[model samples]
Target: SRSLFVKNLNFRTSDENLKKHFTEKLNEGRVQSAKVKKHLKNGKNVSMGFGFIELDSVETATKVCKDLQGTILDGHALILQHCHAKSDDKVSNRADKDKSSTKLIVRNVAFEATEKDLRQLFSPFGQVKSLRLPMKLGNHRGFAFVEFVTKQEAQNALQQLSSVHLYGRHLVLERAKEGETLEDLRARTAAQFTDEQNGYQNSTKLAKKRKHMDILDKPDVMFEKIAR
Candidate 1:
């Protein structure tokens, strides 16, 4: 297939921008078609932060994926992969189901880490299907979920980034369990912290930690209070 999957694009990147990047800026080859995927939300067209590009030939697509894999466009690094042509509907449905297993839970992320930072870190393995960093009070919660296009890519990232440090913090990467949610992760983290504090003799410190956990437990209510 001459088509390529482009991921981690800036939301503002348009279809013309994608075509120009490959054909004009890089001068690599002719782009047959370029499209930044979008959908209508509340009657507004919103970019999905990903796109597809079809080149003149498979070789051109391969070269583009190899050479411009991490090219930054509009402040976000791009992840490129040679995408296979779509199969029949049944196979496509199966692929969609398989995607659930490709998500990774990234713990111990630096609070200062941005989506761009993580995209750059993981782009080498494969196409990043999607990424989410839960936020609170204008900053991330020190964790993220990154879903790759393939389970092998997710596994590779897990093995490679386990020892890597960002902003002076070691990242802990693991395959996300099926049907897991952000609330589940928060509860698990709280449980781990509580277990670590089990033998502590300082009742005052324990009480303070428990109070903090209580605040975290009601995130929506806390956010509402802040809004008011």
Candidate 2:
């Protein structure tokens, strides 16, 4: 199963289009199949803007990846990283990477604090672009990310929130680098929907297109709005 893990795909790109483009780029018929991650909407498959391409062999896959990895396909940046082997199934999808951003990390979060509480706390500084608080067994992981529309807003919020108490816990703040890569984020979004379907969430152990051959095993889901 030699494949290329592609990311940052445009929403309009279809499976047939992916196969055709890769076949042309690689100048061969080694592409066995191409699939875009999809979401289930009233039983319909909605595009989730990321997918994979299967080639005939690892050498062909590697050569195709090398030839097309960073090339713009259908007007979007394509990050063609190597696909992991089936034996690597235990690797968590949330493992950290080097991508950086201006999102501030708020730690020591109150176990019961909600998104509203976080928005209220940071709103005075500026528009809160986005926020994410991971949970496990219905309890906050004691940390979250609050992204401001501007760096100054994030800085201001961090300063004001440095010592504030919420849910009876002092907030610890820091910056996030690139939060999550667009490709990984899409895969993460799909993995979250799959977790919700499975009625479990580890935040750190979510599967990424792993064991996706079955409908029950891999849910087709789009990224949810990052609002509460």
Give me the candidate number with maximum TM-score.
1
- Backbone clash total, candidate 1: 0
What are the per-residue Cα lDDT tens digits for candidate 1 across 91-191? 55554677666788888887767898788777756688888887778988777878887666676667645555665567888777776654665566556
Give each model's whole-structure lDDT: 0.75, 0.64
Q: What is the C-alpha RMSD of each candidate to the true structure, in Å?
A: 13.4, 22.7
Worst 10 residues of 1 by lDDT: 83-92
> What residue runs in model 1 are displaced by over 4 Å at the alpha carbon?
1-97, 181-228
TM-score of each: 0.43, 0.38
lDDT of 1 at 74: 89
